[model samples]
Target: MRTLGNILWFLLGGVFMGLLWWFFGVLAFISIIGIPWGRSCFVLGKFSFFPFGKEAISRDQLTGHEDVGTGALGMIGNIIWFIFAGIWLALGHLMSAVACFVTIIGIPFALQHLKLAMISLAPVGQTVVNKEDLTRKY
Candidate 1:
């Protein structure tokens, strides 16, 4: 079911969203200070590619300890990201979501886009994993 959804998502518009994330990631990487943001973009890009059956959780939850990307620095980084690329990325997702919502078959994809929009707002401290992993303690 997840595979079918992902294939349909890729065929519809997921590929474009992934590409957009990667493009921004490359742009961020061009600046030394933006490397952290670049890494987040790469992560988000992969998530956007095939979001079904997956979830994004705090890095701290995954590791069972606070990491650099899950601390005060992560907050600051998220704020910076929100100010710069986040708003634009979220807007793009929003538009996509609205379009997908126009069709009954696209409802799931629309929800996925909405989820991505929320993630775009603050992706720095999060990591994507299969949904089944949520039940496992770190």
Candidate 2:
């Protein structure tokens, strides 16, 4: 099921999204300031490529920050992201939705993409995890 969804997602437009993130990441790395946002885009691009069986989480765990993922900075960054990549990705989803709607089988997947695209806009400090991972006893 996950594989099928991912394949459809890739077919629809994940490739472009990944590449866009990578491209921006590369450019961001070129400068000292753009590096953070660029890296975030690049990392989040992976999740965008195959979002199934995953969750978007805060980066606090990774950084050991007391309130990394849900803080003032996160809020500000998210707002800025919504203004930038968020709107663009939402458009991408809208476009994809229209294309997918042309066929009956694509409706569900198109809706999924639309949802993910909206999430993509403010993906700051979030990570994706497999849904089944919860079942594994840590």
RMSD of 2: 3.3
**Global local distance difference test of model 1:** 0.89
What TM-scores do the predictions have? 0.91, 0.75
Can you write out model 1's per-residue Cα lDDT over 1-138, one digit (the tens) per residue?
A: 999999999989999999899988998999989988898899889889988889988877776776445678878988998998999999999999999999999999999999999999999878898888786653
Whole-model Cα lDDT of every candidate shown, in order: 0.89, 0.71
lDDT string, candidate 2, 1-138, tens digits = 989888877877778766766765676578766677777877777877776666655566545674545678778877876775678767776787788878998887677667667666777777665667634622
RMSD per candidate (Å) reads: 2.1, 3.3
Displacement of residue 18 (Cα, Å) in model 2 is 2.1
Give the residue spans of candidate 1 off by over 4 A.
65-69
The model with the greatest lDDT is: 1
| CA deviation > 4 Å runs, candidate 2 | 58-69, 135-138
Evaluate residue 27 in candidate 1 and report its C-alpha lDDT on the 0 to 100 scale: 88
Candidate 2 weakest lDDT stretch, 10 residues: 129-138
Model 1 root-mean-square deviation: 2.1
